[model samples]
Structures are given as C-alpha cells and as structure tokens.
Target chain A: MTRIGRRGAGLMAAAGLVAVVGVTVVRPQFSAAEAERPAQVSVDEVEELERAEQILIQRCIERAGFQYMIVPRFVDPVPFTFSYVVDDAGWADKHGYGAALRRRAEAKVDPNERYFRSLPPTRQEALATALNGPEPVGLTATLPGGQVVQHSDKGCQSEAQRELYGDLPTWYASTKVIQNLKGHRFGMVLGDPRYQAALPAWSECMRDRGYRFTSPDAARSEKLTQVVELRQAGAEARCAISTGLGALVRELDTSYDAQLREEHQSLLATRVDLQRRALPKARAL
Target chain B: MRFMKKAVAAGAILVAAMGGAVVSPTSASAAVTAPPPDGHLYAWLDINAGEYYHCRWVGNDDNWTNCTDWDGVARNMHDRASSVQNRGYTKEVNLYNDAGQRGAWRCLSRGEFWPDLRNVRFNRGSSETGYNYPMENRISSHLWVSSC
Candidate 1:
C-alpha cells in the first residue's frame, strides 16, 4: 500500500496548487482499502505541519530583519528501521541493512546549513539567536525521568510552534515525554522473560541455517560485503519468523508501548489533540 | 575565557606528557589525536569541538564530572559542554540535563553533530511548572541506546 493513503488529501490541499494556471496536478493515488483506513496522524500530516512551521519561522525571522531560508525536511527512503531484529524477509532481500539508502541520505546537501555556515561569525550568531532565541528561558516540560527542560518562548521556532499548536508548553512537554519513552519501552520489551524464552528457538533456527549468531541483533551487527550481508539478513528474517521470534517481539513491543502510553495517557492525549486541532491551521498556512 | 584557555593549555601539556598530541583549536587543519572511532559519543568544552579538552565515551555515563577525556585527564566536563558529536555505530545517544540520565533529555542520532549546543534544548523539565533549559554547558549525563 502507498504510505500516503487518505492523509495525502491534507498535503494536497495544503499545497494550494489548484489555483496555478495550466499546471498538471498529479494526484496521489491510493487503494480503496487505504482510503478506508482509520484516521491517524500520518507522515504526510506531520510534513504539512512542518511546512507550516517553516513558513511561520520565515515570517518571524523576516520580521526581525533577518533572511531565513526554509529548508525542506529530509525524508529517508527506508522509513521503517528494524531496531530489534530484521523480521521482514522481503525488505532484507531488497535492502540489506539499508546501506545504499543511508549513503543517499548522507549525500543530500542542506541549503540552510550551507547558508548558515557561509555567514560571518557575528551574523551567524545573530541568525542563530533569531531562530532559536538568545537563551532558553520560557516553557518547561518535566519529563518522565524527573528532569526539567526549558526552551525560549520568544524565539521564532517557539513562536511558530505556539501559533500552530496553540498551547506551546503542554505540546512541548507532551511531545518530549512521548519521544523519550521509546528507550524505556525498549528496555522493558527486551528484559521481558517471554522475549528471553523465545531467543533460543530463534538462535537454533539461525544455527540450522548455517549462521552461528546467537541473536538477531548479533547477526545484524556483523559487517559483510553487500552480497553476504543480504544473504545473512534474509536468513535472519526467515529464522525470526519461523521460530516466532518476530511475532513475539512485535507483541512485546506493542505491550510495552501500550504500558508507556497508559503511564503518560494524559500527556499523549493532549499532544494528539493539539496536533489534531493544528491540522487545519497547518493546511491554511 | 582567558582562564579557561589557560586551563585547557595546562591540560594539553599534561596530556602531551602522557603521550598524547594536543592540537590548537584555532589552527587551520589542526588534527588533534582523538580516541579510536569505535562508536563513541563525544562532547567538547567549546563549540566546534574543543580539540584540547573533550570527552569520549562508548557506554552510558551517569556523571560527566567524573568522566575523563581521551587523554586520561579529568576535566570536570559536567555542565561545561558547548558541543557534542555522536559517532555511534547503530544507536542514538541521549543527552541529559541532570545526572543519572534523569531530567530533561534530547536524542542525538548516529553521525549527528551539534557544533553549537546553544541552539539545542533539553526536551522537558523535571516538573510540570519547570522550564526547558538551554543545552549549552548544562549536559550532565548521556546514554547510548538502540534508538531515541
């Protein structure tokens, strides 16, 4: 299925290209199932929000008599990175370890970075302050780790987020907590007894396949030529699926993620609601 | 600033005595002797990598104050870093505003380098009423993990 799905509509509408005279608009095509899919914040929606944020930031910088270049966000070709194990044989066969994809991503030059570097030291400092604020003074979110973080409420970046999200401090707090939960969740998943119990079968499956790796993570870490790496990755994925390691990992991941979500339900709900409310504003921008 | 420069200079001489090459930070094409690149998370006392005074760790460090540089000299890097670089092989590095990887934190993806931490902020605060603080000279701990 195409990744854009129903969410493509938001991005298309936000493009505001329908009024451009004599322009051929290539619409994003998706299957019926995709169109009927449940509504969630898709990548396209996030991109739309980011686009709007850039616009707001540009305006803010311009208001401060500084030139601001709106750099397009870098989109990775292989979006889904297999952190725990390579469980998809098809993906492994096509893009083993995603080395080529990484190279392409690295090769892409960011004009905003170049422009910032080209400026004089004094101008660079001024531009940096204009974009990120002179100091992080306002808006703090206490994360789950019991640490306090602060950001500048007066900066263009903060101002843009405030305009889009409505409640800057809450949004900042919620998003930060949500983002930081991954590591904790992963730790929980990996430490689960069930996950440990399933590893032996997975290891045996790999051993039968002529790979001596004790775990999927070990197999993934071993560097080899493109040909060998692809073969090994494919074998690992096959073993993972055959031994039910893949399914178990997914289940544990979901379980741990749900627990984390439950722990921070209020924050997550607030963040989601804010983002949902910002959709129209983002599109309007 | 002058005192810091002098301190760094003195530290460099000590490092030189201990069989490490110290490169001037301002010298064009200055290549300081660094730790072996084995998926290390590096932080600098000054922006753009303070060649003379920097710390590299391959694993989680709960306290930056007790951490030593590649030259094996204690620099009390706690709350004194202005830049950071993540050369992690397959994981992202998390920088924390407080010790023991507590408090507000931010993730630095593999191969990502923040030459100036002034532009970065810890993701959250210790309390709902607390404010997000600037990352510059405020990082006290770090952890390397599978992902951010």
Candidate 2:
C-alpha cells in the first residue's frame, strides 16, 4: 500500500473516533435534559375532587333549607348563615384543627355577613373546592329570636322553603349503590338536615347544643339536643359516604387513568426536539 | 493489482481536482446528525391534584391510601424506564405535586418532549387485590392540599 493511503486511513479513523466521542457525550446530555422536564399540569386528582364536590354540593343545594352555596376551599362562608342559625338555636359548634372555618359559630353573625364569614364546615367541601372560586352571598335581616336570617332579596331560598327544610321539619335520605362491574359498595346520605339543609333549626342547633324549641303547648321544649345528636350521627354517616364514593370513583375511571399512564410512558419513550423557542433560558445563577 | 493501482490513482487525481471531497456537505451533515431525545414533558402524578387521587381511589374500598407515602411508586417508575431503555428508547422523568406542607412524591415521571411513544404505566402502590393503609389516616381530595 502507498504511504499516503495508510496515512489517509489513519486520519479517517481518528476523525471517526472524535465524532463518536462527541456524539456520545452530547447525545446523553440532551436526552437527560429532555427526560427531566415535567408536564405543566398533573390535574387528575383536582378534577376528581371537583367532580365529587359538585355532586355533594348540588345535592345539598337542592335540599330545602340548606339554601347556601359552598365556599370552595374556604373554612366557612362570611356572615355564616349556618352559624347564625346554630347560634339562634343556640348549639355550641366544634371542629378539629386547621382553617378558621373549622371552628363552630357562637355569636349571631349579621345576616348580610353570614354569606361572607367563616364557620364550621358541615358538608365538608371547604378543602376540596378551595382552588376554584370564593363564597357568593350576602345577609338580609335579623330574626326576632336574635338569629340573623338571610333575606329573600339576597337570593337565598324563600321563607317557606326554609321553614319546611329548616326549623319546621325535614327528612334525611341515604342512597347506597353497589357498582356492578367493580363490586364496590358506596353510599350517600342526608342524615342531618343541618349538615345537608340550611334550616334555621339546623343553625340553631349549632349554637346551643342543648337549646330547645318551646312548643305552643308551652310546657314542652322540642328538645334541640336531638338535633345535636342528629348532627353527630350525620357526621358519621357522611364519613361513610365519603369512603364509598372513593371506591366507586376509583372503579369508574380505572381504564382512564391507565390510558393516561400509558400516554405518559409513551411520551417518555420517544425522541424530543428541543426547539430554540422551547428551550429554557439559562438562569443568571 | 496493476489495474487496481491505476484505478486508485485515477480516483485520487479526480478527488484532488475536486478538492478531495468524497460526499456532499449536506449529505455528510445529515448522516452525522444524531436523533434528539424524546422531549415530551410528563409530570409525576400529583396525588394531591384531584385527578390522580380520584383515579387511585375510584374502585377500591379504601379511600385513605396516600400516593405520597408509597415510595414504591418511584421505584416502579424507574423500573418501567429501565424496560423502555432496554427496548432502545430514550426519556426523562420527574416528580411533581400541588402546593402543600407534605413533601412531594418522587415516584412519578415527567418529560419534556416525546414522539412515537404510546403508553407507559407503573403500579402507583394502591392495589385492588391487596389491603391498603387505614382510611381514617388517609388523605382525601377534600383535605387541604397543604395538609398532605
């Protein structure tokens, strides 16, 4: 072989070696960077919570006296109609730690502010819908019993509905559904109208746990303590409802989450083009 | 051998006259360009986020299992990545969650870009076949994200 041919072969090999080394080093770096970047929104849980909250809130709103909207993520609503009702009924409120709304309402908050103030969470949606919108309502009038009643002009439920669903008389309903496909048992219930209804009686129960209504018979107090006991029972029932809902919700979306997971993995499996526009700007640090 | 030498000499002369270029610059550049890594962004499933937690709780009786406590989620994710890498694929993974006091989970993967990839999944720790932790202790979608 000529000397030039051997030299040419050696030079070619050296160039190939440099190219391979450079490519190997550069490729992994790019791949690694691409691999680490995360998606903008991981929102499956948020969506699910919102769905569940919507269901419960709708159910609660449809009932007569609970004539109030949930303050998503807020501890309680301003002027707290529920609290005022409880205070008027004179039941002591109590809640576990966390947001201020977790506390029970004592004093009669102004009917106008009732829609705006914080109070104990009964339907238990304050945490779930926190990210969405704020509370929407205002107070109207003070009742003769010192309870501040939200006025009809304020767009709350009418007096008759409140009477039927609230202080007057109310019935609780519970529904149980066993998922056919997944064999999961879930239950939803309106155990206590106070938790589910905006009834003045329910609110009055919140204030004085032992407060009672004097029947026109005048000698007999309609034992408001029964309402407190009812509330405690309702809390227990709601807990069960939450658990059942959890199982059923999981079953309903199994394939969907699976698909999302697959889509995510596929995204991880392919090559990415880091366009100049998409590249992150280098931080000064 | 003499004919081969003559042919080689002729090729060399032609190459020298043509600036010794064996391939067009465009073709050479194209041949050397390495494929980019998959850049599709994937965020780690934020269990705190409503969608992920709801998916995990959909059917199983236990509503209280927390995805964050399940470190196996991360391990499973890494293992899945190994399978893909073994199959001659490229990727990146990351962890993410909503704003809260609890530390974010590490098992989920997020990517920047991806193409020709279809699906990737891993066990997120909760199982229909097995018992999960206590429900009373379990975090719910109704709980504040920060509490997680």
Candidate 3:
C-alpha cells in the first residue's frame, strides 16, 4: 500500500502501488478462514470507489479546458490499505507508522510537471482551482479533545465526495464523528476485560521470549534495529495468537463496526451506497 | 484451526517480504512508545541525538521548557520535534513553531510524515502569511482545521 500526498489540495494521488499479494496477506483475520471469517468490509470496494470518483474528477478538469490524466495513486501506506484497522500483522509489523511505505513510493511520483509547465501562471492557478476548489477556502473540524484540523476540500476529491454523499459540511461532520470514535475504539478493545484477562499471560509469553513489554503496542513501539523489530514482531504475532489477543480484538472490532453501523445508520448508509454505486462503474470500466 | 493456519502462513509471507528490506538501525533502548492505538491523530518526533518519540497527542504549550512528557512530549517539547507522522483520517494538522498556533507553521495531510519540518512553511494558504524561513522547534500551539 502506498499513499499519495494530499498536497496542493487540487492534485490527485499521483504515485504508489500495492502488490496484489499484499492484500491477500493482509489482516490475519481475513487471511485465515473463509468460513469463520468475522464481519468486516472489503477495502477492495473502497479502492474501486476511489477509482470511480477519479473518472468524474477528470471530467471536471476537461470541462475546465485542461488535460487530466488518470493518476492511479494509492493513498494508504504499504502493507495494508486504509486507516480503518490494523488486523494485518504483516502490514502492522512492516509499516508500524506506514511512513517508510510513503518514503519508498514518493521517489516514483511525477506531479505532471510537464503539463503544468506548459501553462502560464494564470492558467496554472485555474487548473488548481478546477481540480481542487477555490484556494484559501478550507473547512475545519474540532476533535472531542478540542484539537482542530483545518483541511482544504476544494479539489476533485472533495467534489467526488460531495457528489456521492450529497453535501460537504454535513458529510464532513458525520464522518469526523465516526473518525473520532475510531481513535478510541481499538484502545477500548485492548483495554476490555476479556482482552485484559489475557494480558498477563501474553506478557509472560513475550518475557519468556526475552521481550519485556506487557502490551503488544508497547513492544511494537520500541525503536530497535529493523532486524530486531522484525524478529520480535514475529514472536509477538505468535504470542498474540497463543494468548488470545488476536481472536479477541478481531471479535471486538467486528462488533464495534456493527454497532457503529447501527448507531450512525444514516451516514453509514450513504457510505454503503457509495460503495455499491462503485461496483457498476467498476464493471463498466 | 484453519484460520490460525492461514494467519501463520500470512506471517511467514510478511517475514519473507521484510527479510531483505533493511532500514537504518537505531540504538537499542528499553524505552517503548507504542503508537497511539489506531484511529487517533499521531506524530513521530526525532530529537537531535537520534532519540525519537512517536507521540499521540500534543496540547497547547507556550514554552517547551514549561512542558512535560506524558501529556504532550515531555517538557522542552518546544523546538525539538524534527519529524512528524500524521495518522489522521480526515483533517490536515498544522505544525507551528510557538505556542497558541503562533509563529511559522506547516500543514500536513493525513498519513504524511515530514521526517524533517525544520525548514518547511505553510502551503495552500497565501505565501505572504507564512514565515519565509525554516522553522525548527518554533511550534507552539496548533489546531486541526479545515485547511492549512
């Protein structure tokens, strides 16, 4: 998984690639069984929708009298796709923060310098406005903790989203609500009584293997040599499985997702519709 | 049982993928800063001496010397955050040099890490509003807003 920089507001994801195999090897839960597979949504659907949105964005550019080439930039960092979950141990271990994945993929990016250079500054500005929206007009959403994030959505991405979800402001607020909840969801699962009951045993298992952290996250946070992190990560993954953290977190995540779907039904319904809408477009493509 | 087998197999594939991809080595430490559990905003700060901290939340601190680690990034969190990891889902976070969202600032989209924000400045907004020089350790207060 590679994430394109969300820069210049108007520019699309222009660089990055994920091996098809990466998806198969992602998320321990999904990889293991076709039968006992817990409830989850396919990121594949999301990716397809993203591609569909790009088609509309390109049309927007053409209408503006500028040539727009489809830039199939992958936005999620390597080893996994999206920011939703980290059930994929391979991705989790290799990407930790997913920064390296971006670093590796960025070197291959070409911001269509040739096309942009062909235009004068005035036209360039127009192109940016056409692709993104008017500059200096951005939106801000404050988190529960009161930290505020200001972002520009005047671009093709924003346009695509609006076309799908109806309006920007309401969609933005609704989505942020779920996102803020997301920040706490995983921590909640790991801290749950069921998950907590397995902690001591998991810690013991790690300690027996010469690791000291009581929690998997702590062990993963250690800044060891890549080799050491990799080696320890393997043991940690096994420990998680043996100690039941793996099974428990997956179950909790699925339950939480279901609960969220019900709690935020209207907004989530819009999202589900967005995914379904992408399938026909995908087939046509 | 079959699921566990599949997970183990996936793990093997990952180990193989990571086998030859060697990253630069850092000194060993018992210190562990688990990334903030998924879903919240986070940034990675690396100090001058190769010491790095993966931080979850940063608050309003007027001065670095006046800060503490547990809540923000410890005291002296002022001008030392050389890098940042933006794991945000929707918003673009602005990194300012000075407290209360003052001084030179830079905005990063979600899932971006400026291994170095030392000399970076604000984009998207007018260039006239941002500092012309590189801003290191000058970030004071920041808020997540609609655009940077």
For TM-score, the strongest prediction is: 1
lDDT of 3 by residue, A1-285 (tens): 112223323122111212334543444534364335323337786677667777877777787788877766544444321222233457547754454565565444334434754677567556655554542123444434333333346656567766755566555555565565553454456547886677788789889989887666555433466667566766676677777766667777777767766776776665455545445545354
Off by over 4 Å in 3: A1-48, A62-67, A73-130, A135-153, A179-181, A273-285, B1-148
**DockQ, every prediction:** 0.04, 0.01, 0.02
DockQ, prediction 1: 0.04
i-RMS, each model, one decimal: 14.7, 28.3, 18.7
In model 2, which regions exceed 4 Å deviation?
Answer: A1-21, A36-245, A250-285, B1-148
Order the candidates by DockQ, highest first.
1, 3, 2
Name the best candidate (by lDDT).
1
After TM-score superposition, what is the CA distance of residue A50 in candidate 3 from its true location, in Å? 2.0
Candidate 3 CAPRI grade: incorrect
Question: How far out, in Å, is residue B118 in model 3?
Answer: 24
Per-residue lDDT of B1-148 in model 2, one digit per residue for the tens? 2123432443354445447446332222122111111111111222111011111111111112243211124211211111111000111122211112121221211111111011222111211111122111122221111110
Per-residue accuracy of model 2 over A1-285 as CA lDDT, tens digit each: 254467569668756766887776666766686568563222543333333444443444445233344333322322322211122111222421112333223132333225322433332223112211111112122211121111111111222223222321111000000001111111111122222343233324323434332211111112225444445434322332333432333332454444434544433222112111111110100
Q: Tell me the TM-score of model 2.
A: 0.17
Task: Please report how far candidate 3 places residue B133 from its true position, in Å.
Answer: 29
Cα deviation in Å at residue A225, candidate 2?
Answer: 13
Residue-level lDDT of model 1, residues B62-140, one tens digit each, is 9999877756677788999987766443356778887877666778754444555775666433221112566888899
Give the Å error, residue A100, model 1.
Answer: 3.2
